[model samples]
Target: MFMNLLRENKIVAGILTILRLYLGYAWFTAGLGKIQSGAFNASGFLGNAVANPVKGPDGSVVYAWYVKFLESFAIPNVDIFNFIVPWGETLVGLGLMLGCLTTAAAFFGLVMNFSFFLAGTVSHIPTDLFLGFIILAAGYNAGRIGLDRWVVPFIRKTVLKGKEPAKQHA
Candidate 1:
């Protein structure tokens, strides 16, 4: 019942828009700061994550595999992270703020949030993850006030044509 309202109701949609804008602003500012710094690099961050992964109650690494992956793939490819992180954050912000692809943007934002959380960075990740989930759960309604209002329908009509059921005989 509540999910239905969140997915369809205008009042809930308005609330979601506010949430989306706030999240977008956060992402935009973070990314913009990195870009503006002109020397922002993910190597230090990735190194820190690899050095101090989230620990379990038993004092063992909670995400050992992820730490390994980061060491093997991410740390070596720090150059890629240097490029992808800031730009990806900025793009996610733009997509969410403009409501162009709200669900996708929120999904990616959640992925990044989880990554940070798993890397022992608590910060605002829990709140961001919760809000990202809300935006995703709201789904199409989340983007109804923005470009997805038109773009989604256009894609459904054109790209997904010929998939609709034809009229059946009595």
Candidate 2:
């Protein structure tokens, strides 16, 4: 019921647009700051996550695999992270804010939010995740009031231009 409303209702799209704008602004500012500073690095954050991984009640590492991943992959390739983080965030923000590819934007936002949570950085993540989920779940309706009104159809036509529906085997 609620899901249908979120995915189909224009009224709900308006509400979702507000959430999208707010979340988009947050991402854009954060990313733009990093890009502008020209000093943004992922090594420190990734190193810290490795040093202090999430632990269980028994003092055992809850996500040991994630710790290993950070240590072996993320930290080792911090340069890649440094390059991608800011650009990725900024692109995601632009997409969401302009509603160009809203669902895709929300998907990436959730990915980053979860990555942060996994790394134990818990500032504004919960709220971002909550709202991001709503926007993602709402699908196209979330961007019904924005550029998606035209962009989506254009993309669909361009991509599926020659594609035909499958024939039914009677």
RMSD of every candidate to native, in Å, equals: 4.0, 3.4
Against the true structure, candidate 2 reaches a TM-score of: 0.93
lDDT of 1 by residue, 12-102 (tens): 8888899999999999889888889989888888899988788889998989999998999999998888888888899889988999889
User: How far off is residue 149 in model 2, in Å?
Assistant: 0.6
Candidate 2, superposed: residue stretches over 4 Å from native = 162-170
> In candidate 2, what are the lDDT values of residues 127-169, reduced to their tens digit?
9999999999888898998999998888777987846545434
> Looking at candidate 1, what is the lDDT of residue 128?
94
* Candidate 1: segments with Cα more than 4 A from true spot: 162-170
Q: Alpha-carbon error at 56 in model 1, in Å?
A: 1.6
Please report, in order, the local distance difference test score of every candidate based on alpha carbons.
0.88, 0.90
